[model samples]
Target: MAERVNRLNDLTPREWIRFQKSWFIHNPPPREPGVLVHPGKFPEGLAREFIEFFTKRGQSVLDPMAGTGSALVAAVRSGRQALGIELNPDFARLAEQRVQAERLALGDQAPQARVHVADARQLDQLELPPVDYCLTSPPYWDMLRQPGFETQRQRREDGLPTTYSDDPRDLANIADYARFLDELVAIYVKLHACLRPGAYLTVVVKNVKKGKRMYPLAWDLGRRLGETYLLKDERLWLQDNVRLAPYGMFNAWVSNTHHHYCLNFRRE
Candidate 1:
């Protein structure tokens, strides 16, 4: 029997994107408490896939918006050094604990991973080492605010107001989406100084719909950041685990598919 060599010509552009999505199609099993504490965190499997595809072992990887340190965990698991910066104090502490626990289990050879409680927008002030790759997911604008009150998670946790969706405070607080976008772009721009040339930056973001208005957040991010770095390709992260839409009950048309646009760029 002969070995098979798959050629790029075997698939069309759309097919190639679909193929990549296929590899990550399965839903991540619910995490056990003490293992991971956040729902917004990216799946470790996806983070590992990005780290493996973008860099070699021993290389350094960074995740600025490292919610629960998912990317950091992935980097360490892949034998790459990892650094994460988080804005939320609770999430940062949780990430630090998780990494420390993992280190205790995996020993020193596992990539050194650390998470610091700091604003992603202020990386210039943080003493972070150079990075070979950066993978992160930004907070989806206040969709949790859809209801008048806080999110269940926010409510369950004392003093933590509902945020990142449908919340008035979360959405209303950002009076300038343009400013928010610019600030995010500037953060990555600052991060570019730390990346090795040719290193890849992957951002997972999605468009937002509110009040019948669409914010091309993902697209605009690409465009604005494109000036600082080379705007490369994108990967669509399709979630298959969401409940079916209930458009029939309201006689409305709603999309059941939740997709994240994984934008890949390179430091120039």
Candidate 2:
């Protein structure tokens, strides 16, 4: 099949609505008021799209950083077997509970889904099946932390944290951009072992702006993982529902009309 060429602000109205339905906007329901570094969870609609695009019914899908079970729930909804590993014990338990609750709510409609509390850096210890498709979004450093005094002041009493991974050893914890890229790429290399031959791996990531520095996370991931897997293509997740940017031409030349890159790779 010919790859789809997507650019920011080029999606059709139908495509835009499909993106909205597949994933919820960044706004989430209320939670305990604490700094949630990685509190932002993915919507099931987008997850289902990746799951359906890469796997068949009853195929196994794995998520190494299964935050809150978004990908797992989506896989189940698509009638695919799902497995996940999370480092945080709290998040892992939450993911497990959410998967079970989803199954109960879905009744016979749900596929087999399971989640384990494990670190992405040490997938070798975890006994996971050969995954047909591995789809996930890793932490985007500490960008989740409150940015400036003005932004912090605007934050609500109960809001998501600036960084999700509390692990001191997490790749997001590394301050050096190069080191962060190396370690993050290493995690994906480890994941390469868990994928079946000729299977697909889609990573949902984006470059991050922190302290006036740009960390090209998505680009680096594509470059590094491309060494092990074929750099297939990318699809942009454009969001038209986001608040308009105020600094496009003022003090800062920021363009924030909503978009994320879905880098696709295939294990050779």
Candidate 3:
């Protein structure tokens, strides 16, 4: 009998099966001060889970909007090459600092990680190598700038930044929803050039609400970006540890959204 071939990743059968479940609860641990300086970033642990499941060791992983290099650090931790593109030079420098620290802790066994200071929209100009997997999260359509936004409110009181940057080109600063979606899709489309054929890309995002209107950013991306990359499926990242917020408790039905859509796409 021949040994079974696992083309996607190095996961054992049991681990692979477990990752197939469509929803999971992962409450991120407290952020270290170095990374906490960034306004928004997914946990490195979560990124590693996706990286380990999507590609084997020594493969390359990229995060186009690498806020503080969460995905890059996760790649090195999982024995993969890491590449990242950060728009803000300040954040880019910070990401490099964190990556270097992580690599030093692991010593020579750690894979190489590089963070490029550039906008993701200029992906094609960056001359990046084709990658095996890409995992990233775009800003949630300027939700941080919305007055009285729950998350930003807390961030403000803590003296931390409530928004990504003041750069006019930053997607998080775009005030118009339609324009923001178009530009975001364009950036992802450009990502196609950096992804090897059959590579998978996972986008972690959620819908946003402005007063009574809810914008389906996740669903919209699934449809629009599907034109450039195959819309494979979706997994929900549930956060159960969050303290519930009383939003519109007395007047209307407003849910304390604690789940994020981890939309998976593949380059055919």
Q: Highest lDDT: which candidate? A: 3
lDDT of each: 0.73, 0.74, 0.92
Clashing pairs for predicted structure model 2, backbone only: 22-45, 22-46, 36-161, 37-163, 37-164, 38-163, 38-164, 144-162, 145-162
lDDT tens readout by residue for model 2, 45-110: 778867876777778899998977889988887778889988777778877877787788878778
Candidate 3 lDDT over 1-268, as tens digits, reads: 9999999899999999999999999999999887667878899899999999999999999999999999998998889999999898988998898888888989989888899988888889988988999999999999988897877778888899888899998999999999999999999999997899999999999998887989999999999989999999999999999998888888899898999999999999
Q: How many backbone clashes does candidate 3 have?
A: 0
Order the numbered candidates by lDDT, best leading. Answer: 3, 2, 1
Q: What does candidate 1's lDDT look like per residue over 1-268, in tens digits?
A: 8965533123345644554652245476776565434546678888887787778778888998887888888888778888998776777887887777777778857668888777766787887887889999887655544452223455547444354333232222455677767667778899998898888899988887665467898999899889999998788777787667464367755455478888999986
The superposed Cα distance between candidate 1 and the true structure at residue 79, in angstroms, equals 0.4
Best by TM-score: 3
**Minimal lDDT window, size 10, model 1:** 164-173
Q: What is the lDDT of residue 110 in candidate 1?
A: 69
In model 3, the clashing pairs are none
- Misplaced by over 4 Å in model 3 are none
